[model samples]
Target: MQNLEEAELCFPQLLNISCKKHIRPQAEAMFIYIVLSSISLLTVALNLLVIISISHFRQLHTPTNLFILSLAVSDFLVGLLVMPFQILLTEPCWLLGDLVCALYYLLNFITLCASVFNMVLISVDRYVAICDPLHYPTKITAKRVQVCVFLCWGYSVFYSVMFLYDNLKQPGKYNSCYGECVINIIGPADLVLGFIIPISAITILYVRVFVVAVSQARAMRSHIISVTMKHSSTVTAKKSELKAARTLGIVVAVFLMCYCPYYCVSLSLVIGSSTEALMIFVAFFNSCLNPVIYALFYPWFRKSVKLIVTLEILQPHSCEANIL
Candidate 1:
């Protein structure tokens, strides 16, 4: 009876090689499951709302909104596909086979990379719009943004496949026992390709953006000092540019806050235990927070959500309604 009770193997029939399940307290596990599941559901719902709002409203079809739409799509997939599986990972045993596990992480990387790329595109869009307002319309058109979004997803797919080639080719390569799902890709490659390079690019772009924004602010102040009616239209355009820079700046800041800790740990090669789990979910939780950021900062997003919820979007010609 003692030996039978001590045998806590994930696969009872293959007890010799099977992974031992570290059974957490039932109540604790249940609570964790509930919380993570709720987060996943909320993430899916919020991002879906963002997706529906931007995609359905013709008035929201501007170049900037197109970037938002692409971002929401990536976050939506994170919620829909990635979060559920992530929940499974938190568990003690991996009932889903090794190939599925590899594929799950692969999808995870793709969605995350796509989100990062979308943010980069957004930063570039804002840079041009704010710093070079005259050429913005010509440079950052709807068609061009669409092409960029497609390429972002395509690149993400290729990168993820390339990074996880070994794991995909030979599933369970890292698992020492049955019913364990773990992939240990080298840190240096991920550190550079996933974190350092992209982060450096974003940092440089934002620095340039900030310098231009400060100069624009000074110029606007000078124009106000002159107090000329002829400069009224120019003042309004400058105000719009400053407002855009501020809003997107918040978006970038929030993204960095969420992602930085996880990457820092990865770069340091100190990932383990509950701290690692917390860091990962902290990053994942950013997906849920992004749409909320839009709601708070973007009046158009709030208006569009109202239209979507009230079934007003179903009305003919509703897409033409002035959301801005």
Candidate 2:
């Protein structure tokens, strides 16, 4: 009995103060690890492709693609850094020391904030494109998008520092035993700054976008009936309709499906033992889904993927190749 008890302790040498390791069946543990690892790899690969596709292709250097590149970079970091550490979080004990754990969560918060802000930028981009197409070119320039991306990341860093300042000042302050790693951001601050405000903004913007989209759709149908087929402006209107449809699908799925449940559960402060991990995984899974959505909906993404895989991207003047 003593042997079994010692085996269950995360640090057997520490005796009473050591955290008790939660052992699972070997097969179950292996299955869970395999699944999570696969997701981590997939997330990393997909986001990397997006980063490469946008960065390398000159034709993709528009304001919208620049926003996507920023989003991809954050998601890439999440997969590369955050998701792997999350796997560690699922382990019976944190093998890494308290300071590393603190820093890990710090990075996680920064990336999460960056992703949220990037989404906000994306929403704004789509809003202008759909609702005010005539002025979009002047209003949403590449220079402005680049500035927004820079500010988004800078704010994320500052916000995360403020959020984790206490924990950083006293690492392991919340740990009750050796071999454990846990820290909590202030609940009210997290709820307000991290969840409530951003979500509200995204919701309001999307609602306005939806309302405009409906009105425009009706207008387009009536215009098509009055206009002749030879009008090239009708083609431009049809293209805008398709872009709006794709943007709507991506925005709704990403915000509602991936982010909403996690924040709701977190803010509710009623994380079920069985559901907490699943909720977190769902949130991280969104990073991977974004690129896949692009691949499915954007032909340029498919073409870029093909070029990248075939190593044609290395050919002379490949960057200038007509992807559009």
Candidate 3:
């Protein structure tokens, strides 16, 4: 009887311990889901607003602005369609069934690759225009820009198809946490080809771009001083060029601030395990930061926002005037 009583007491203790262990993981998962969902929603809304403002304003439709719009579109889709699903199904498993999981992963890969490729194209465009102004129009013609954009999408689709094929063939072979869609082991090859290579190329291109821009700025400054006593025409042209360069600089700065840490964290994940969660968080934060940075730092975007607000305010007034 004494032995039976001891066993009964111990059984309750064991059950309690087991419950606590399971509850902790559940709570942690819940916390992560809530935080990630909030971030995703905020990012999606911001990007959507930017896209709408740019699309509605005819004046904001330059080639550079078009590229930014494409980026904003990609970010918006990812935040709205991908991140929420990921946060909600945090069991490290693909809970949305196989077909949906495959599609989601494929879209994720394509958008991410497209984002990186677009950044490279933007950097190259800036470099050519700033460093070789005489040939800018000829070298970066509208047709050439269209070709570049098409090629970016083509490469993104190709890579995504290949990745999807491999993932589908294996199903859950390389997945972690049983039936999950995550890469069980993020190899060095994956890191290099997927992120590091493109990031390095972008960094080199931007470095050259910076050097050319600085030289151009210095030359413009000297010209302004040399022509200080002359007519204002040359000074006005130089000032316009300076303003354009300043705008480009802001764009590059925001791009670097948003992506540099993300790539660094991703590359580090290839070498260490201590930073897995932190790196994931940093990468996720990149999508959210881009729209905010644009709104805060880009005058063109700010002007668009003002125009949108003004139009909204005027619509009712115009309607009332007509009614009157």
| The best candidate in terms of lDDT | 1
User: What's the distance in Å from true for residue 225, model 2?
Assistant: 4.9
* Descending-lDDT candidate ranking: 1, 2, 3
Pairs with backbone N, CA or C atoms under 3 Å apart (clashes), candidate 2: none
lDDT of 1 at 238: 76
Off by over 4 Å in 2: 225-234, 241-245
Tell me the lDDT of model 2 at 102: 95
Off by over 4 Å in 3: 1-30, 92-94, 175-179, 184-186, 228-274, 309-324
Model 1: how far residue 322 lies from native, Å: 0.7
| Worst 10-residue lDDT window, candidate 3 | 15-24
Question: How do the predictions measure up, each by TM-score?
Answer: 0.95, 0.94, 0.75
Q: After superposition, how far is residue 182 of candidate 2 from its true place, in Å?
A: 0.6
Total colliding residue pairs, candidate 3: 1
Query: Residue by residue across 1-324, what tens digits does model 1's lDDT show?
Result: 746744688888877788887888999999999999999999999999998988888887889888988989989898899989988888878999999999998999999899888889988988898778999989999899999999999999999999999999999999999988888787798878877888888888888999999998887786687867886887887787788778888888899999999888777767656677788898999999999998898898899889888999899999899988
TM-score, cand. 2: 0.94
How accurate locally is residue 131 in candidate 2, as Cα lDDT from 0 to 100? 77
Q: What lDDT score is found at residue 179 in candidate 3?
A: 39
